[model samples]
Target chain A: MFLWIIQRDLLLAMRRRADVLTTLFFFIIVVSLFPLGVGPEMNMLRTMAPGVVWVAALLASMLSLGRMFSSDHADGTLEQMLLSPQSLSLLVLGKALAHWLVTGVPLVLMAPVLGIQYDLSTDALLVLTASLLLGTPVLSLIGAIGAALTLGLRGGGVLVSLLVLPLYIPVLIFGAGAVEASAAGLGAGAHMSLLGAFLLASLVLAPWTAAVSLRISME
Target chain B: MAINWFKYSSPASFYSLAGKMIPFFSVAAAVLFVVGLYIGFFVAPTDFQQGEAYRIIFIHVPAAWLSMFLYVIMAMWSGIGLAFNTRLSSMVATAIAPTGAMFTFLALWTGALWGKPMWGTWWVWDARLTSELILLFLYIGFMSLQAAIDDPRRADKAGAMIALVGVVNVPIIYFSVKWWNTLHQGASVSLTQSPKMASTMLTGMLIMSLACWMYAIAVILIRTRAIILERERHTVWVGQLQEATQ
Candidate 1:
């Protein structure tokens, strides 16, 4: 059931390529804008890379969060899913997983490329990629809760950002810390381990919260 | 005889109970604030280190503590409301948010004032300050979510979800503080930890915290009364009260 939902979401997402592409471009533009705002110093960019990329990634994922439910919600498929006998939490988990695949995975794969723009070394780039890989799922999972909560609300996209961004802080800390530690030649072992623990914990908690919110929003 | 718990869960009964409680808390808060401020300004000797400027800690620490404390309380009210489908609890959660946000902003402002002389900068992204700033953002988020929804009950449940998510992530603030310090310890910046204070200073700070607690309760009660009136305006008791007041 879970894999089917993931595949279904992926198929639906594949048809709406512009939305996925927009998230990527928004991330790139936002990230590139930082260097322009801060000046062209490679050393400064290197130092700021972890924070910049993570924040941009966070914002980009927020863009895709609205798409998580809006389409199915509009089409009434969400009501069907809610009415189904299958566990809604599992369904929410599947949607979050699919969201990460469509939006988050690309960001992870593309992060090293951005890291290069910031003059990050190969080692630091690897750490950046690893951190995003672990961290972005946490973002998607947590974000699903926000997305579900705000579904059909008048305040729209920016409102979800207002609600969800604060919850992203710990993930931001460890994810950026891991990359920053690597950039400084320190082992990222502790930060990565902590990020993993956070991811696992959110994995259990976020979907249930999201599922409950979906039910409430549907009402 | 068994206590009738559900009676107070009703808006009309809670309204009268809250009305009765408000003046007592208001008086207590006023008295405590005066006592706390006197001890803070007079009884506590000038700090050996930062001097009079460190007196900002009296206000800053309590506001900071209340900001964190109220978020937890708000979340608990929201969680209980969500789980039990209780309207009054949700109203309390909603009422607590603005006051909590005020204290968070107060904490940040007061901290900045204190930080200037001690750190030679208004802000340094210190772990505590940064986390408190994020907390302000969290409170804003919760309130924003509540305001955006059209249906009150839907808003309550949706906000409850964020509140619960926030509760789960509350520990993140502590972890982020630890991680931030470790990540920055190697930097040349020597943002000093606050020095150990005199006993009088500690007493004053505690008293200030109590004052904040009383103030928050009084304010929340008053606000919750308004909320109850607005939400239950169509109820017979509220209508009768409105008629009597007019």
Candidate 2:
């Protein structure tokens, strides 16, 4: 049942390819704008590379988060899901998983392009991809809680960012730190482990919280 | 004796109860502040290392302590609201947030003012400072989420969730100094150990911290009363209470 829900969300997301493409485009444009705004010096871009990418990823994930539960709730699908025999927690998790697949995975895959644009080293590129791979899923999971809480609200986009950004701080610190550590040829393992622990913790915690939020918002 | 758990849990009951308690707390807070300031500023011995500049700790440490202490209280109220579905619990949580945020700003502001002399820079990405900055953001996020939702019940629930999720960050911030070899100093007044400072300095800091706590209670009680009235405007008690006030 959970797999079916995941498949359904994936198919729905694929059908709205424009939404996916627009989000990705926004990610790229926002990232590109950072270097332009900060100046095009390779040395400066390299120093700022980890932060710029992480910030872009954070913003992009937030842009996609409002759609996570909002569209489903809007179309009455969320109500049907809640009323279904399948547990709401599992259903919400499935939706969040699909969201990570669509939004976060693409960002991870596209990191090399972003890395090259920012003149990141080979080591930095590897670390950036690794951090994003571990980090962005946590963003999707945690953001789901915010998205669910603001499911039916106007100005949810602004509220969602406000609510979620603080939660994103540890991820931002660790993700960027991991890449910077690797770029400096230091061991990035501790940073990566912390990110993994964070992801694991958020995965365990966010789904139930999201389910409760959905119930609250729907009520 | 069974605790009157539900007695003060109702918004109407808490509203009236809070009103009765505010004056006492306000007076206590004012008295403590005057005494603590006198001791902290004039009576406490000068630090051999930091000299008069170290006097800022009287405000900085207390503000930082209250900021974290209030967040825990806020999250506890939020947790109660989420777990037990109490309207007053969430209202209390909402009432505590702005003050928590304000103290966080005060802590950071005073820390910056203190740091300029000690650390020789206004800001550094030092672990403690960074985590405190994140703490400020967390408070703002909680406030913004609550304000954005039009429905009070929904907003309370949403804010509770954010508060709960953000609570996990609090411990991380507290321990970040220890967990990583960061620039922030380890705790000087931990419960596990005798305080590292002189007795007079400790006395002054403790008095100031208590003053801050009393002030927080007074402010939150006052704010919660306002929140209860605003939220329960349609309730009979609110109308009667408004009439009484007028």
Candidate 3:
């Protein structure tokens, strides 16, 4: 079921590759601006890279979060899913998994390339990728709950940020910390472990709440 | 005797009870604040390191404690409300947000004042301080989300989910920020320089925390009463009460 949902989402995304690429471009542009805003001093840019990349990813993912349920909710597919005998949590999981795959994986893939722009060492770039790879799932998972809750509301795009951004801070902290630690020659292992723990916790917990949120919003 | 827990779950019953309770807590909070301040300003020996500036601890620490405490409490109330579908519990959670936000602001402002004199900076990315700042953001997020949603019931459920999620992340954020801070700056903040707490200083802090607790109860009760009136306005009792007041 999960694989099917992910495949469907990917197929749909492929049909509208522009939207997916827009997200990637948004992230890339946001991260690139920092070097221009704060002069292209190699040392300073390298130091700032972790926070900049994490924050841009956060903002970029937030833009995409609105789409998580809005498309289905608008077309009435969400209501039908809620009414189905198949567990809503699994469906919710499938959707969240698809969101992570479509949005998060791309960001993870793109981050190492951006890291190199800031002159991140090979080790730092590797850690940044590992961190986001673990951390972004947590974002999609938690964002799913926010997306589910805010479905069909006016100005929901902003509302999803208001709901999810604070929740994103932990992931940001650990994610960025891992990269920064690696840049400083400290092992990123502990921070990566923590990020992985967050991923696991959010995985177990978020879908159930998101399912409940879908029911409430639909009602 | 089996206790009927559901009795006060009704807003009307809870309303009258909270009204009766507010005054007692208000008086207690006022008295404790006076006593706490007296001890903090006069009785507690001036810090050898920070001198009079350290007295901000009385307000800062209590506000900081209340800020974190209230989020957990708010989350618990929200979780209970969501799980049990109890309207009053959710209302209590909503009422707690503004107060929690106020405490978070108070903590930040006081930390700024304290930090200025002690650390010679208005703000530093100290682990605890940054975590508190994010906490302020969380409270704002909770209140904003509630305000954005029109249906009060839906708002309540949504707010509850955010609060529950926030509770889970708050610790992770704090620990990670702490790790990040320590990795960057070794022990720079005055609070880290550990002045041995004189007994009188501890007493003042305890008193202030209690005062904040009482103050929180009184304010929340009053706010909850207002919430009950707004929500239950369509009901006969509220309508008749409005008529009687006029």
Task: Specify the highest-TM-score model's number.
Answer: 2
Q: Give the docking tier of candidate 3.
A: medium
TM per candidate: 0.94, 0.96, 0.93
Query: Candidate 3 residues A187-212, lDDT tens each?
Result: 89989999989889888989998998
Candidate 2: CAPRI quality band: high
Which runs in model 3 stand beyond 4 Å of their true positions? Answer: B1-3, B169-196, B242-244
Error of 2 at A138 (Å): 0.9
lDDT of 1 by residue, A66-115 (tens): 99999999999999999999999999999999999999998998899898
lDDT for each residue of candidate 1 in B79-195, tens digit (9 for 90 to 100): 999989999999999999999999999988987888778887788766666777888888889899999998999989888888877765456454555555632122111238443
TM-score of 3: 0.93
Q: DockQ of every model listed?
A: 0.83, 0.80, 0.66
**Clashes by residue pair, model 2:** none
TM-scores of chain A in all candidate models: 0.98, 0.97, 0.98
For all candidates in order, the CA lDDT equals: 0.88, 0.89, 0.87
Q: Write the per-residue lDDT of candidate 2 for residues B19-54, one digit (tens) a residue.
A: 889999999999999999999988999999988998
TM-score of chain B of each: 0.90, 0.96, 0.90
The fnat of each candidate, in order, is 1.00, 0.87, 0.63
